[model samples]
Target: MGITIKDIAKAAGVSYSTVSKALNDSPLVKKETKQKILRVADEMGYQPNIAAKKLVSNESRTIGVVWPTVERVALTTLAAKINAALEQQKYHMLLSINPTKTAVDLFNRFQVDGVLVFGEEAHEEIISSSIPLLYYGEPGPATYPTIDVNRRKAIQLGVRHLVQLGHSRIAYIGDLNPQHSNQREKATGYTLGMEEAGYSHLHEAVDSRGLSWQAGYQAVKQLLSKKKPTALISASYDLTVGIIRGIKELHLTIPQDISLVSYDHIPEMEKLDVPVTAVGTPVQTIATEITNHLLQLASGKKVPPAILDVELFQRQSSRSPE
Candidate 1:
C-alpha cells in the first residue's frame, strides 16, 4: 500500500487527525505545524487517497479535458496552459483522448467537477451528463457554453495587413475541407478581405486543401510553379513553418523575395528565421478564459457563450512587395 497520512504523521511526530487536517490544508492546524507535516509528507512520498476523499466529500476537485485531436500542436499548448491555470485554483486536470462522447461519459462516472471539450472537425453525437460542460471552439450546435476565438477576423487582419502593404496579389494557404468549420471561416475571411480590396478576380490565389507543414510546402511549391503571389497568408503556424521551408528550398527570402503572414498567436514564432507576423487570440488568454469559465460552471454559476477577439502582430516576415 502507498504511504498514507498516518505514515506522514508518524514521520512528522503529529497525531493522525492533525496530519489529516494539515493534508486538507485546514486552518485549524497551526501554520508552522502544517508546513512541517506537508514537508514530511512530501519527503515520505505520501500519496493521498483521492478516491476515499471523493467518497467522503462528494467532490473530486478535478476537471476533465476531452480533446479528440491531441496531435494538434496548438491544442496541446493550449491544454498545457489550461492545466497550469487550473492547478493555480487547486484543481487537478485529467486529459482524455478518447472519443468525445466516451470521454464525457467516463468523466461523468468519475464525477469530475467540470468538463471542457476541445473542438474538432468530426461531428460528435450529444451525450447527456450532470457535470457542467464548457466547449472551446466554434459554437456550432453545442448546448454547452462555448468560448470561440474570431478566426475569420484573425485571417482578415492578416489579409488586410498585406493589402495595406501594397500586396495586391495575395494568396491564402489553409485546409479547404468543408467539414473543417474553423478553417472554412478563415478562408471566407480571406475572400472577404480580397473582395474588400477590389481584388475579386484573384480568387485563384486561395488554396484550401491542406493544414499540415507538408501541405503548405507543396501548396507553395505549386503556387511557385504557376505564378507566385506578392504575399502569402497561412492559416496556421505549422503551415507557416512549412511555407518558410518551401520558400528557402526555392532560394527565396521572406519580405525580400516573398512576404508572408501566418495565423495563430504563439511566442515561439518570434524565434523563427524571420519573426513571423501572426494574427489570432493569444493562447494564454484563451486558456485563462476557459479555465475561469470552467471554474464558474463548477461553482454552479451560469456562463454565457464568449467570443474572443483577435489581433494582428506585425513582425519581420511581412513587408511591401518589391
Candidate 2:
C-alpha cells in the first residue's frame, strides 16, 4: 500500500494538520520543522494528493496550453521549452489539442490558474470563461492578454536580405488563405519589401495549400515552370524543406543558380545540402516571452499584448547575384 500523510506525520512525530501545513510550505510552520517534515515525507515516499490540496489552497498550480496544430515543428519546440520554464517554477503544464472553444471549456472546467492558446484564429463560437486567458496571436476583446509576433516584419527581413544580395526578382511561398492572418502578414511583407527594392512588378507570390514540405514542393514546382524568380522565400520551416526538395528535383543548385531563405530558426533547415539563410525570431526567445506572460498571469498580474520582431541570418544558400 502507498504511504499516506498520516504515516508521514507519525514517522515525523508531528500532528497531521502540522504535516499538512509543512507539506504546503505554509509560513505558519517553522522552517526547520517544515524541512524535517518534508524530508520525512520524502523518505516515507508520501505523495501529496494534488486534488485534495487544490480543494484547500484553491490553486491547482497547473497551466493549460492550447495548441491545435501539433505538427508545427517550431511551435512544438517552443511549447516544450515553455513547459520546462513553468515546471521550474513548481507549476505543471497541461496540453490540449481540441478546437479553441472546446479547449477553452476544458481548461475552464479544470480550473487551471491560467491558459495559453498558441494561435491567432479562434473558433466561431468561443465560450467566454472566467479563467485568465492569453493568446499567442492578435489581441481579441475576449478579456485576456494576447501576445503576437511581427510575422510581416519577419518576411520583410528575408526579402530585404535577398534584395541586398542583388536579387531583383523574388518569390514568396506561403498559404494564400485570407483567414490565416499570420501567412497573409508574411505575404504583405514580401510585397512591401519588393516595392522598396524597386521591383514591384517582379514580386511573385505562391500559395502553399498548407504549411508542410509537400505543399512547398508542389507550389515551388508550379512556380518554377511558370514564372521563376531569382530567389525564393519560404514562410515556414517545413515549407522551406519542401522548396529545397523542389529545387533539387529541378536540377538547380542553391545560391549558384537560385538563392533561398526561409522564415524560421529550425536547426534542420540550416543543415540542408545548401544551408539556408533565415529570418525569424529564435524559438527560445519566443518561448521565453510566452513563459513570462504565463507566469505573470498565474501570479494574478495583468499582462499586455506582445509582438516580437524578427531578424535575418545569412547562410550559404544565399549570395550576391553578381
Candidate 3:
C-alpha cells in the first residue's frame, strides 16, 4: 500500500498537522524537523494530494491558459514551452480553446491561481474576474498585466533590411482589419518604414482576408496582376508561405524576381527553399516572459504590462532588387 501524513507523523513522532506543515515546507515548521519529516515521507513514498490541499489552502497552484485560436502552430509551440516552464515550479497548466467570457468563467470556477489569455485579435470589452489575468497581446482595461511584442518595430526592421539591400519598390501584405490592433501596428510599421526609406511609391498595402496561406496567395496574386512589386513584406509567417507559393505559381523566383521579408519567429521558416527573413521576438523568450509574469502574479507579486523586444534575422529570401 501507499503512505500518508499519518504514517509520516507516526514515523517522525509528531502530530499529523506538524507532519503536513513539514511536508509542505511551510516556514512555520522548524527547518531541522521539517527535513527529518520530509526524509521520512520520501522513504514512505507519501505524496500529498494537491486537490485536497487546495480545499484547505484555497490555492490550486494551477494556471488556466485561454488560447481560442489554435490554428497558429507557432502559438501551440509557445504554449507547450510555457507549460513545461510552469511545470518546473510545480504548477499545472490547463488550456482552453473556449472564448474569452467562457474561459474566464471556467477559470474562475476552477479557482485557478492565474489565467494566461492569448487572443487572435484584441477585444475592447473587459473580462471581469477575481483570478489574476495576464494577456499575451495588447492590453485592454479588462486585464492589467499584458505582454506584447513590438510588432510595428519588427515590421519596420524588416522593411529597413530590405531597403538597405537596394530594393526601392516593395509591397506590404497584411490583414487590414482596424479592430485587430496587432495587425494594424504591423501595417503602420511597414508604412513608416517605406516612408522613412524615401521609397513611398513602393508602399502597397494588400489586405490578406485572413491569416492563412490561401489568403496570402489570393492577395499576392491580385497585387501581381495590378502592379508587380520587386520586394514584399508579409505580415505573418503563414502569409509569407502563401506569398512564396503564389509567386512561384506566377513564374517568379525569390531574390531573383521578388525578394521577401515577414514578421514571425518560426523555426520552419528558416528551413524553407529560400530561407525567409523574419523579424519578431523569439517564441521561447516571449512564452517564458508570459509564463513568468503569470506565476509572479500567482505568488502575489505585482507585475506591469510589458512590450517585448523583437530581433531581425536576415535570411536568403531577400536581396537587392533586380
Candidate 4:
C-alpha cells in the first residue's frame, strides 16, 4: 500500500540486494551507488518499517499510554503535557483507550519501550508483562512503580484555606462511593480537615453520585435547596463547572453568597465564568515528574514510589464569607 524498499530498487534500476546494502549504507556498496539509491528512495518517499527497525536496534522509541476512561477532562491536560515532555526526549507516544489488560497486551505486542497506565479507579491490578509499566493515580500493586498525588491532602488544603477565611460552615460535593478510592481520598480529607480546624460539628457533605458536570450541577442544586454553607469545596473539575452553574441558577454569587474551591489545578479553571481557586500540584509539574520516571523505567533504572504534594491556589472564587 505504501512505498517499499523493493519499489525503490526497481526505480533505481538496481538488484534487490544492492538496494538493500545501499539503503543500509553498507560499506560494500560504493559511495556513489549508496547516494543514488538513497536519492531514489527519498524520491519514492520510502519509510522504514518500525517492526523491521526493532529487529535490528531492539528499541522502538515509543511509549504506550493506557487510558481506560476517556471521559475524564482533568486528565486530558496531564496526558497532553506528558506527550510533549516525552517528545522532548525523542520518544513517540501511543494512546489506547481499551481495558487495562487489552491495552497492555497490545503495547506488549508492539514492543514499545514502556507502558504508562492512567489509572482512574481504586484497587487496580495488571497482568505481569516483560515490558516496563508505570501507574499514575490510585495505588497499584506493591511492586509496581507509581506516581501518586496526595489527593486527600489536596482536599485538606482546600478546607484549610476556607477555614482561614473565617468560614466555619463549609460543605463538600463529590462522589462518596466507598469503593471509589480516588473520591474516597478527598472525602476523608474533608473530614480530617474539618476536625483539625475544630469545626467538626459544622462539617457537611453532599454526594454528587457521579463526577460528571450534570452530576455536580444536580448535586449542588439539591444541596443548596436544603442548606446554605458559607463555602463549598468540590471534588473534581467537571463537578466545579456544574457547581458554578447551579450556584448561578439559584441567584447566588461566588464568595458573596457562597465561596468555592475545586480539586484539580488545571488551566481551564482560569477560563471558567468565575476563576476557581483550586487544589493540587499543577499538571505541568505532574507531567514532568511522570515523564522523568517513564524515561528512567525505559532505561532499566528502578524508580521508587512517588507521592506528590498538593497545594491551594487562592483566586476569585473563594473568599471570606460576606
Q: Quantify all predictions' global Cα lDDT against the true fold.
A: 0.86, 0.84, 0.87, 0.90
Residues 183-278, model 3: lDDT tens digits:
899999999999999978767999997888888999999999999788999998888878999999999899899999988887878887789988
lDDT of 1 by residue, 134-210 (tens): 87774534667988889989988988999899998888888877777777888888999989899978864446476
Best by TM-score: 1
Clash count per candidate: 0, 0, 0, 0
Candidate 3 stretches greater than 4 Å from native: 1-49
lDDT of 1 at 144: 79
Candidate with better TM-score, 2 vs 4: 2
Would you estimate the TM-scores of all the predictions? Answer: 0.93, 0.89, 0.85, 0.88
Off by over 4 Å in 2: 1-4, 10-14, 21-46, 120-122
- Compute the lDDT for candidate 3: 0.87
lDDT of 2 by residue, 60-176 (tens): 888998886877776777788888888888888999999877888999989898898877463456558788888886444566777877889988888888888889888999988
Kindly list the per-residue Cα lDDT of model 4 for residues 163-230, writing each as its tens digit: 99999999999999988887899999999999999999988999999898999999999999899899
lDDT of 3 at 171: 93
* Model 4, residue pairs in steric clash: none
Q: Which candidate comes out best when scored by lDDT?
A: 4
